[model samples]
Target: MSSQAAAIAPSELLEAARVSKAWPFEEARKIVSRLEKEGGVSRTVLFETGYGPSGLPHIGTFGEVARTTMVRRAFELLMPGVETRLICFSDDMDGMRKIPDNVPDRAFLEPYLHMPLTRVPDPFTNEYPSFGDHNNAMLRRFLDTFGFEYEFASATEYYKSGRFDPILRRVAERYDDIMAIMLPTLGPERRATYSPFLPISPKTGRVLYVPMKKVNAADATITFDDEDGEETTLPVTGGHVKLQWKPDFGARWAALGVDFEMFGKDHGPNMGVYDRICAALGGRPPEHFVYELFLDEKGEKISKSKGNGLTIDEWLAYAPSESLALYMFLRPRQAKKLYFDVIPRAVDEYYQHLAAYPRQDVKERLGNPVWHIHGGNPPAIVLPVSFALLLNLVSASHAHDKAVLWGFILRHVPGVTPQTHPELDRLAGYAIRYFEDFVKPAKVFRAPDEVEAEALQALSVKLGTLPAGADGETIQNALLDVARGIERYQDHAKTSPEGGPGVSVAFFQMIYQVLLGQERGPRFGSFAALYGIDNTRELIARALAGGDLSEV
Candidate 1:
């Protein structure tokens, strides 16, 4: 989104990019090769992200836009001075198939069923004329909030203003050919009623799904039986006709001359259909990037309609947008569960990448996600501690506010303050919220077993022996020695189950559950360093006495 191509694109960077192992770089190479064969970027390359405005835009919507922007950004670096345009296209003109489960005034939408979404009444506020307009506004708000650079295109406006007229007429002329391509994909019931163009009913103001009685290619109109069985003819041009979803996908590409686009794995099966229709309509299909879809906690696809997965609002409440962008950037082709448990790790990794950027070489920086996240210029936001460490600090110290948490932080990082390190302050607040909402409610604290109790006793005595100023690694090494020296665990460690976990892992897991009231935790050494060694010993004492150390 920011123009740093000229200043940052050195010869070495360019050479490395030619063979860079980054996914965005690989994607950009595809665009570069395609454009070279076609026309060599003489015209502006168009990148598009599609949306259906049946409901408010969700986190998945944000993710698509964010990922597409990453590729668009890569293209900019490789082909600097080549004009690029990104369009976020919304199919608002599509008919409302059913009332949404999340909207207000559900009874009011029943009558508008099968009507165009742009024509349906807004169920929330009267700020917009229709539900589609409201949702489109919400989409733009979040996109703009993140400062994404793109143009917004509405299907209703494009159709009503005759912008798609040429394509519409061409589709009408080849109606039979397009139908031949689509008919075999459906069953007999659907094939018997399918048409390339769905005519908007003049009488009932609904999108009619009936078969075309007659098609006049010369007039660019279809004669269809209306809701009342009356034969009516309407021009396919203008807003009278809209193509079905798959055809619309191809037709839109043809109309806009899209160069690059991407979607989830769910759309992989229909790529052939989209490509054929675009080719049949005299347009080249754009390069496609299909990523695995996100699953909910139960491993089902995250459906915006069902509201079964994490929403954008829920994530922002507990983490920063950069963390979300990082989550989207990593392993895009692999399916990940979009759940609350991912936020803390994402936040920590994002900063870890940012902190590592300055020291890395150009090639190494190019492979890092933060380079793409910040358009090759990641901010120098150094977080002094890990997010896990911060959460553990709040866990052990019972910090209910910034004032108390900052006390611990200032001691760990003497010069850092809220005014200078705002990200750190925000992270403190997020850690508290996350701990309260997720960790506290889910914590299962049980008294340590005899073997674990022996380990804890040794660890406590070992900590008490260390000097007042013992460092994190020092305390950590001492704790490890204690775990390895325990006779009961030592025997189990040597002759354990073949596939079982290492004793070191079991040792940490026991300490985390017993002392922190959680099944896992941050690096014990770093955490002990953050929460002073003396304080850590007190935590061990509390756990041994059967007190809830998880409370804050």
Candidate 2:
């Protein structure tokens, strides 16, 4: 152990190793321990995450990069002062096998089929040079917004700049050996013509997948037949040739000296193939981690081609980036359902972590997801109210502005303003938007029955008796007393069999429907306390009055 590692308590290190048993951190610990054992290494450890620029960036892309970054952070915490580099590699040189159906103006991209994504015109707008460029821009935009520290590598640029020349030569020299490894995995028809090197047609500029007639390893050139019957020869050193998927993956690992890489479980079967190819070319494969894929609400696998999952933009619109980071911080080996419905809980969970961060001890704090989400410096401010409560406040009070929400917030958490708690303020906006979309549309208000109405009336009277300066706990207890009283009344009234309204789940649902125009909401007590006694009385009276419940 180094001085820094020694400075850290052994118990703390043990805790970190224990946290690593969960996920990503587990993989990070494995990689760091393995690398530590391999002496004489004086280079920075390279951690790479990649994207296939076939479609616009989505939540899965964000998840992969975000999770890898968390692991990188965990690695840093475990092995202090170890140099590390993270690269977001984009495979933009891959030919446009087909124009994605989700893109705008698909008809316009038809002409560019079979060309590299970098070569296809961006059908959405001329703002970007090509489809690949536009997608790369979107990827970088969110990455920058999330504050990920990474170096972006474009396959098109890397190949054309001769940076991959040595790998290309290695692929050429080991073509037969690579074929031996790949052929067994393909069908007979595919095996008959499969070649590791895919030479771009000099005539049509399309990437040709035809079998290589001859490979001159000494000359670093390959010979293949073009679209016509004529044979063509091109130097593979430049961008004239690109390797197939499996070989490209292995070659990239070998060329970049990637120490850690991860992919979806769909690629789990291909790990050994890439590892073998990399080892064959005198390069050891990186430490690999495979995570399960995200699923949509219907339990279908989220796919870029299927356009079935939530997009990163949609997620950002409804929740803070930290919430999304927390979602990614969970165990990666387990499949997670990603949809809009999960947003509110994620938002509240992030706030909970922030609230708990300062109170935790140093060892526990280091292992907290908030520590990684905030890069070891979690914010000190804690909102007394959760995001769900904020949403109810937005709906109940018609708070169209952050100032209005802060009016309630400042009452509980004094000395904090929208300026100091920007994340909370941002969440307030998302809450309002989410309330408008998901909550408002589905609300169906039903009048409370007679006994229930009487209970609410009694609750209102009790609330009015409370002092104006009553705290949340006080208000919460009063509200619970009202609920318990209603329940006792309902239990006695049950003997009469429909003589009075029953205080069941419907009672609480009715309250939610009346105040927030939803069948479910935050805890009534906490909400009542945060919303203030006076406001609570007004909302309850409005619900009982059978007048317009909107003004409450």
User: For residues 1-552, could you state the per-residue lDDT of candidate 1 as single tens digits?
Assistant: 222222444777778788878888999999999999986678899999999999888888899999999998888888888999999999999999988888877898999999999999989998899999999998999999899999999999999999999999999888888998999999999999999889999998998889988888898989989999999999998899899999999999999999999999999999999999999999999999999999988999987667777878889999999999999999999999999999999999998988777777788888989989988777777678888998888877878787888887777666899987888999999999988898878878889887888788889999998886677889887876786666554534454334432245778888888887788887898898778878888888888887866663
Report the backbone clash tally of model 2: 0
Cα lDDT listed for each candidate: 0.87, 0.82
Query: Which stretches of candidate 2 lie above 4 Å from their native place?
Result: 1-22, 410-416, 419-422, 486-507, 550-552
TM-score for each prediction? 0.95, 0.90
Clash pairs, candidate 1, are: none
* Whole-model lDDT, model 1: 0.87
Q: Which pairs of residues clash in candidate 2, taking residues 3 or more apart in a chain or in different chains?
A: none
The Cα error of candidate 2 at residue 22, in Å, is 5.0
Instruction: For residues 1-552, write the lDDT of model 2, one tens digit per residue.
Output: 011112457667656655644465677777876787887446688999999988888899998899888888878776767799999999999899987879867888888888888998887888999989999999999999988999999999999999999999988898888989999999999998999898888788788889988999999998888989799999997899898999999999999988999999999999999998898777889998899999999999987756787999899888878889998887678999999889999989887877776666666666678877876667665565689999888888777777888898888566778877676787888988998777767667667778768878878888888887777677766665566566544444443333554345565676787666787877787788778888888887877888676554
**Which candidate ranks first by TM-score, i.e. highest?**
1
Runs of candidate 1 exceeding 4 Å displacement: 1-9, 491-503, 550-552
